[model samples]
Target chain A: MSVITREEVAHLARLSRLALADEELDHFAAQLDQIVGAVARVAEVATADIPPSSHALPLENVFRPDEVRPSLTPDQALSGAPAVEDDRFRVPRILGEEA
Target chain B: MSLIHESAAELGRLMAAGEVSAVEVAQAHLDRIAEVEPKVHAFLHVDPEAVLVQARAVDERRAAGEELGPLAGVPIAHKDVFTTVDMPTTAGSKILEGWRPPYDATVTRRLREAGLVILGKTNLDEFAMGSSTENSAYGPTHNPWDLSRIPGGSSGGASASVAAYQAPLSTGTDTGGSIRQPAAVTGIVGMKPTYGGSSRYGLIAFASSLDTPGPFARTVLDAALLHEAFSGHDPMDSTSIAKPVPPVVEAARQADVAGLRVGVVKEFGGEGYQPGVLARFREAVDLLESLGAKVVEVSCPSFEYALPAYYLIAPSECSSNLARFDAMRYGLRVGDDGTRSAEEVMALTRAAGFGPEVKRRIMLGTYALSSGYYDAYYGSAQKVRTLIARDFDAAFHQVDVLVSPTTPTTAFPIGERADDPMAMYLADLCTIPSNLAGNAAISVPCGLADEDGLPVGLQIMAPVLGDDRCYRVGAAVEKAFESRWGGPLLKEAPAL
Candidate 1:
């Protein structure tokens, strides 16, 4: 059985917000199947007792005083926005068709 | 006697002594970039006027008797992936094209504070995902030695800028082998600081766990100096190491490995390895033994699984980290016509803005993290990661440092493996183990391979927080090789 099928790739593209074309779906399905096949060998590495490492190094939460410090001004903050309106980022409507 | 060929150390010294001015040094490099960039294509952006403004400021500070950093007036290249408030901070993708960042990356701010002239941003694989720069939405950066070949990526331009002598120092982010592999192919020096050793604040994320900002230079000592000036505890980065930076500069100057134990990784050599690359790596090991270092072959069986594990782990992190690029806030956005909803716009924007490789990773990561298959894919890969780290722990117990061929082969011709993702991934086979373990590793030019007559790299790795060890061993190998070749290996590269 193939690791990933064409329909699954389309499903993944939707989940990933990619909107891949018909050709991309076909090409990627084939390639991803091969990649997943090769990488699946890791599933066979059964060190049942060993723990999984979520990070390269152990991490901890950082704490800071509840005080404000100087940071980027609103103009600087909005400088790179694709679209801005009234000191805020402009965007398309949020509600989908059902709403 | 142009100033472009002078090392960063030499340039800084001359600028400090008042024997030379920063503008003069910057102009020489800018002139060289103009001359060679047409062929090398090492920089994605260069503004001579802005470059001069920074250079002139350095000279003014010196005139005021201000004590500047060691590399205060030296010119350096900034990788485009780092957010630079003054220049476009594209991660080699159209999504971020023409996007001037609101803040500088910690690395960029450090470079500016140190008075290093920012010539411009260098190119990389889009989001630092690929082994070669062909994935760059902008055109690929060509190898200086052989224009027909790649310069090792996603720091390809970072390595090429220094190799082509356009700049003596450049910054790079190593997610896998981006820095070391490029340095190996270009006949230069590159170092990946232990994860969390360098601040990543303002760096555009790519596999946040594995992405590490490091240095690329023509010499080991120069790399260490740059490493120190920027690396230390950063309150902004929760993961940044709170401990003092390692004594890398001191180690580079030590340049002696007498009585030090060196382990040659047994798994890195053999079938699928190029014969000439193996031969050069063998010579480097023998040279270490001749210098009174105790040499032994060490086996790390888990390293065999590093590639697949890294492919899954990196893509998984990338998928999560890159979610910020939705069409709502910053960067490229498309199909925002009022009739369409935000979700539709986001899908259209991502599809139009991202290159194929980035898209591939995003999808792969989505699949890996999705339900049902999560345990079989992402879960298994995490387990493999633990095993890889354990192998490093065991090897470090027996050896002070580990060594291997930086890459499987020399720089292959451009477009040779472009269509085959697996073939391209093989280029980073020897370098991924260190990234997985978050250990300090450095790659320095060993010698040219006989087959392709291209430069080969000797990779030296040390334990976490033991970054200085890699530089110590690297400096020793560099000194001996320079003495044997009568100069650095880059001196043998054909003129552009």
Candidate 2:
């Protein structure tokens, strides 16, 4: 199997949204290559027509009754929050806003 | 009470009779931990003061003539994957380092109700993703037997702690053999309860469908005592079985193998297994026959593909289950340059939060589940899963239980498979099929490998929900074998 190429690592990093240090990229490339190569063996038999089985048990519709039950209060939910403001978890804005 | 090595049932008897105070039992384990932990590295955290507090509470309740739980005053460590209300549960990942859950997992709540004192969270693979505990963002834990070797993984820390006698009992979760493999390498007893037998409401998800929480201890009956305390129905987990918990403890005590139909899998006893492991497994099978149990060879043909299919399906579910760790809700976040797109920040946060192995799984999962690849990848893997299950059903019809080498080999040096990912994944071949089939399995130390003198695990597996059978037959086999070996394998483990 081909080793994970630098371009492939860069693409995967982009997909994973990781900002890899220049020094670490080479090491990760080798590790990712080995892992992907090992896992990629699934392709040999994973042909079309077989429905994927995500769960081992065959049971379906594992839903709880939609009864309104107790829930963690905002304080409890956010108790371990690193940053919070106005009863909401605070985070950097996703879409850039007007300064 | 200094005989903390006594089975949990024995300890409970003494505690109930007021022969030993819970505080004294807890203190002895605390002192034992102090002497052993630096060498074992089994624990990520140890709160002796908190342990004492819980033990004292158990003592007070017993003093007041109140009903106490079975494991009262027993000290146990939990794998970091189980969320605890009082202790920080990081799931052995840096992303959630020092993050404490607002509520305890069902297993933790059950442990508390049983009056067991929580020693602290033990180490594990990061997010329980890898086979060896080496993948933990925290430093790797060394095996107690050979300080330079591994104690097997994901539940490595829990197994190591028990093997090193830092704690008498501990809790571990198995997904792809985490509990069993670790116990095998560490020379302790570990079991994966039937799927949904133990609630997974609070276990951090790696592969949600496969994760099953169970117990690890020094002896079969101790594992039985711990399992009795933890296994039950939980409203919080949809998959939690509402049926009465099986009588595993009683079965262990019965320890009857007479007339028990034991099936030895044809596929598992083949090439790639260490010679010592093969010999030990053969001896175990022979012992069962001598004890009046009929041993027959059975075949699960589709199991050969189980490891490959599991790799795909586990990662696919993992990719989806772990998507919640995006920087927005919980866990760490990283951002540079105050101005950035929401999408950009999400990416940066994920990149920073996930370790290499986690990212690798996520990427592979994402790739598998991607629209075009789903049919070819995840789809076929699932069909193979059905085939694997069918193969198991066919075998179960012919035998009451199956046996194999828990792992292909005993413990190797820490870095042996670090760079060889395929080799690492192969270590779990014998154990993976049990998880894929959602059956109950246990790994008890059969003997030490002749070559390295490292521990080797003899695995016992049963049909889905055939948990009691595994314990029943396992206890009998262990009794017969340990007598010849002189004692439990871990008892000879070097004092750390």
Candidate 3:
């Protein structure tokens, strides 16, 4: 069976918030299937007895003092924003339907 | 010899002695870039005025009788993935095409503090995703050895800049073999420090768990100098190691391997490996033995699964790390025709902004981490990751360091493997296990392959916090080989 179908790829695109084109969907479906098939080998040796490693280091609860530190000014913080309004990021309507 | 052709250490010495000014060193490199960049395409951006300004500052500091760092007044080509306040940090992606970062990466800030003059930002794979710079949205960087071939990537520009003599030192980040593979093909030294040895704050993320910033230079000593200058504990990076940085510079200077035990990885040779690359690596091992080092064969059985494990784990982490690039914040945003919703605009912007390889990984990551599939894909991959780390742990107990050919082959012609993701990924086959295990690894140019006459790298792997061992062995190999080749391997590169 194909590891990934075109419909599944489109669903993944939507989940990833990427509006992939129709051609891209077909092409990616084929490539992703092959890659997924190859990587499936990982499951072959990942027995339940073996513990998973989320990170290379065994770090935990890294903390810093709760004191305030100097930070970017509002202007500096929003300098690279695609759109800004009143010292805040401006985006298209979030809740409203398209006009 | 031209100032541009001098090593970083040599340039620094000359500058400190007042024989050559920092401005002269910077200008010489700028002139070299101007002459060769059209063909090499090593740099994505160069501001001569800004470069000279920094160089002039260094000269003034020296004239005022202030003591400076060992690398004071030397010029460096910074990989574009590191955030730089003065220059655009593109990560070779169009999404952040002209985004001027408000902060410098810890590596960038430390280099500047060490008094190294920044020449400019060099090119890289988009977000350091692919094995070749072919994935760069800005266009690929050509290898200085053969313009038609790739300078192994995602750190291709950093390696190529040093190889071409446009800059004596450069910074690169290795998530897999991004730094070493490129350094191998371009005939330079690249070191991937033990994870957490260098801070990653302000570095554009790829796979946060696996990403590590490192150094590239023509000599082991120079690479070690840069490595020391930018490494150490940083509160800014939560994962940064709290211990003092290993004495790599001293180790490089020692350049002796007498009585040290070296292990040749049993799995890295034979089938699928190029005969010429294997031949060169074997010779390097022989040289180590002749230098009084004890050599043995060690097998890390789980290493065979490194590639598949790395592919899953990197993309799984990248899927989360790259989520910050949504259209609303900073970077390219499209499809907001005053009528579309924010969500629609974001989707359109992302679809247009990312390259094919980046999109493929994002989708794959999403699929792997999605509901009902996470356990089978991502969870299993993490288990294999544990096994890989255990393999390293077990091997380190028996050997001081493990050796292998850095990559499977020398530089392949550009565009040969562009459409084949698996083929491109194969370039990093020997270097991935270290990243998965967070061990220190260095790739030093061993010799030119017999078949193609291109450079092949001998990889030296050391245990965590044992980064100096790699340098000690590397410098010994470098000294021995330079004696045979008459000079650095890059000297043989065709003149631009």
| lDDT (0 to 1) per candidate | 0.93, 0.83, 0.93
Error of 1 at B67 (Å): 0.6
Report the C-alpha displacement of residue B483, candidate 2, in angstroms. 2.1
Question: How displaced is residue B136 in candidate 3, in Å?
Answer: 0.6
The CAPRI class of candidate 1 is high
Error in Å for residue B141 of model 3: 0.4
Instruction: Residues B1-496, candidate 1: write the lDDT tens digits.
Output: 5688888888899988888999999999999999999999988899999999999999999999998999998999999999998898899999998999988889999999999999999999999888779999999999999999999999999999999999999999998999999999999999999999999998899988898999999999999999998899999898999999999999999999999999999999999889999999999999999999999999999999999998899999998898899977789999987899889999999999999888888888899999998888899999999999999999999999999999999998999988788889999999998889999999999999998899999999999999999999999999999999999999999999
Q: Rank the candidates by DockQ, best first.
A: 3, 1, 2
- Chain A TM-score, prediction 1: 0.91
TM-score for each predicted model, relative to the true structure: 0.99, 0.95, 0.99
TM-score of model 3 vs. true structure: 0.99
Pairs that collide, model 2: A52-B379, A53-B382, A94-B342
- Where does candidate 1 clash, by residue pair? none
Misplaced by over 4 Å in model 2 are A1-5, A22-52, A62-65, A97-99
- For each candidate, the DockQ is 0.82, 0.50, 0.85
Local lDDT at A7 for model 3:
96
